[model samples]
Target: MTIAGSDSGGGAGIQADLRTFAFHCVHGASVLTCITAQNTQGVTRVDAMSPEAVTAQFEAVMIDMRVGAIKTGMLLNQEIIKTVAKKLVAFGCGNVVVDPVMVSRAGAQLLDDDAVKTIREQLIPLAAITTPNRYEAQILADMEIHTLEDMQTAAQKIYKLGARSVLVKGGGFTNELKGIDVWFDGDRLEVLQTEVIDTPHTHGTGCTLSAAIAANLALGKPHFQAVQDAKNYVTEALKYSLAIGQGQGPVGHFYPLLNRG
Candidate 1:
């Protein structure tokens, strides 16, 4: 299941997440925390759901569904963050893949300082694996990330927060360094790389990658293998990105289906 916001444009958030789960052959479920009036042009307004409503969704899923794993994206505020975290623990939901969604791929700030703090303190520690893009990693680690060494440091620091593993995504890097992700699990540091697909329609890449990781975990793949598979999936999706909107669009979640013919 994915606990995330809704993107009315259907490029990211719940739309991308469910599609990603489907591609992995997993039954997808969602608990929406916010609804955004957005398109490829950019996000305009966001309306967050009440914490009670959010918890109600969690209860419904936990009771009825045999959820193998879960991922979180675009948790709107501290109330929602704490609420989701509390319920996850109450129900003994493990294999939590946290996508620390504080910024957009275009470098827009999607979260406030208070919400960032809550994610760091409350949500991240509960993660089986936490995937933070370059900008989000910099914010969480309290350091500027410039080189690969910095990414390694950030991964280690984020792991110190109690996540069993950390994936510091480098897709934000342009030119030669693009599409490299740093993985660290307190003992070993590994870099996962993919050939960058040169395309403007790369929105929702972060959301899709994390959701893919969650789906792989649900299928019982181990930590490193899951992250690696998700990275490869995102890279391939980028190759088939759609040019649907006036601005940047989304990676193709059903690219494999396109290849199936």
Candidate 2:
């Protein structure tokens, strides 16, 4: 299941996540915390859902479905973050993958300090794996990430925040660091690299990667294996990224189906 916001543009948020789950052959369920009026051009408006509505969606899904794994994205505010974290614990949910969406790649803060603190203190610790992009990693680990070693250090530091593992994503990196992700479990620190697909249509990459990780976990792959497989999946998907919008588009989540002959 994906607990996230809605992207009306169909490039990210719940839309991208469900598409990713479908590609992995996992049944996708969702709890929408907010909605965005956006397209490739850019976001024009965002409306947050009430915490009660978020809880209702969670209750409805958790009762009927046997959610094998779960991923979270674009949780809009502190109230929603707290509500989701509380419910996850109450339901004894496991195999949680957290995509910390607090900061943009360009160093813009998406969530306020309170929400970020709630994510760090309340939500992320419940994650089986927490995936943070470069900027978000800096916030979580309290350090600037400028090199591979810094990424490794940040991954290790973030691991101490209680996630079973931390994946410091390199999507925002330039030069050779591009597409290089650092994974740090309590014991192992490893760098994961994949071929960089040179394309501007990478809008949903972060959401898609975390969703793929959750999907692989649902398929019973081990944590490290799941993260590795997800990286490969995202790399391949990027090869078929769509260039439809005036601005950045999205990875081709249905690439396999598109190539069926």
Candidate 3:
């Protein structure tokens, strides 16, 4: 299940998550919490769906669909976060992937300052895995993360906060080095590194990665294996990204399908 907002540009958010799930050969389901008037350039406007509506969608999906795993993204406010968290626990869902989407690639704040505390306190502890980018890691852990060592420390700190596993993504780094995503499960830590492709078509990378992980989990892969496979999928998608709008475009989410074709 992909619980996120709709991206009118079809490059990020729910659109990208669904595309990533399809690429991974998993059935995709969504519960949209908001809608964004956005493009490759940036988000122009946002319309939040009412909490009642969000709950209705969740009920509709859960009652009819047999979801094996769930992924959440872009829940803008504390109300929405609390609502979703309650439903997850009520429904007894497993294999939950939480992508703490706090801000957009264009630097627009997607999550409110007040919502961060709610997410960290209420929602994160219930997740099977929580994926946070460097900036998000800093916010969630309340620290400065500038290096790989810092990422390791932050991952551990976050684990102590209640997450079963943590993946600290290093995509926001300004240095000209390979991208490294660190994963920690309290007892073990692994760095999944990939050559960073210098490209502007990476609009929905975080959403895509989390969705890919959900898809793999639904297919019954182990947590570490699912993360590794998702990382590889995102790497290929970025490598063959398509140039769309005037600003940062989107990765080639259909790369595998296109290759098959």
Candidate 4:
């Protein structure tokens, strides 16, 4: 299940998660935390839901559906973050993937200081895997990341925060580490990278990656394998990304079906 915001463009947040789950042949469920008035250009407005509303959605899914895994994205505030964390533990949802949605790839700030702190203290500890981009990693690790070593250090630091594993995404990095991701499970560290697909239709790459990982986990793949599969899926999506809107289009989640021109 994807516990995230709703993207009106239908290319990210709950939309991306559900499509990703469909690609992996897993049934997707969603709990919308906020509604984003956005498209390829940028987000113009955001309307966050009440904590009680989020709770109702969580309980509705947890009680009725036998969800296999969960992925969280775009939780707009501390209340939503803390409440989601509580529900995960109470519902015994073991496989949790936390996509700390603090900022956009375009370097836009989407989360505030208090929200980040709450996620680090509450939500992250409950995650089986946490996916944070370079910027998000820098915030969580309290350091700048310009190299692979820095990625490793950040992963270790985040792991210390109580997550079983952390994948410090290098997609935001420049130089050699671009499109490379560092995964550390408190035991072994693995670097996953794919050939670069030159495209600006990467609006929801992070969300898609984390959702794919959750989908793979739901299909019973191990953590490392799930990440690997997700990387490949995102790469393929990028290769065939749609040039839908004016500014930056979203990755083609249904790329498997469309013939790229």
Least accurate 10 contiguous residues by lDDT in model 2: 252-261
The numbered model that scores best in lDDT is 2
- Across 89-178, the per-residue lDDT of candidate 3 in tens digits comes to 999988999998885533456677789888999889988999998878888888988788899999999988888999998888876424
lDDT of 1 by residue, 1-261 (tens): 999999999999999999999999999999999999999988899999999999999999889989999999999898999999999899988899999999765577778889899999999999999999889999889899989999999999999998999999988887556888899988779988878888999989989999999999999999999998998899899999999979989998898988998
TM-score of each model, in listed order: 0.98, 0.98, 0.96, 0.97
**lDDT (C-alpha, whole model) for all candidates:** 0.92, 0.94, 0.89, 0.91
For residue 203, model 2's alpha carbon misses the true position, in angstroms, by 0.7
Superior by TM-score: candidate 3 or candidate 4: 4
Ranking by lDDT: 2, 1, 4, 3
Poorly placed runs, candidate 3 (over 4 Å):
105-109, 176-178
Q: Give the TM-score of candidate 3.
A: 0.96
- How many pairs collide in each candidate, listed in order? 0, 0, 0, 0
As a TM-score, model 1 comes out at 0.98
How far in Å is the alpha carbon of 83 misplaced in model 4? 1.0
Q: Which stretches of candidate 4 lie over 4 Å from their true place?
A: 259-261
Model 4 agreement with the true structure over 1-261: per-residue lDDT tens digits: 999999999878999899999988999988999999999887899999999999999999889989999999999998999889989989988999999999776567778899999998999999999999998998889998888999999999999999999999988865789998999998988888899888877888989999999999999999999999999999999988989978788888887777532
Per-residue lDDT tens digits for candidate 2, residues 1-261, read 999988899999999999999999999999999999999988899999999999999999999989899999999899999999999999998999999999987779999999999999998899999999999999999999999999999999999999999999998988689989999999999999999899999988999999999999999999999999999989989999999879999999988887794
Superior candidate under lDDT, 1 versus 3: 1
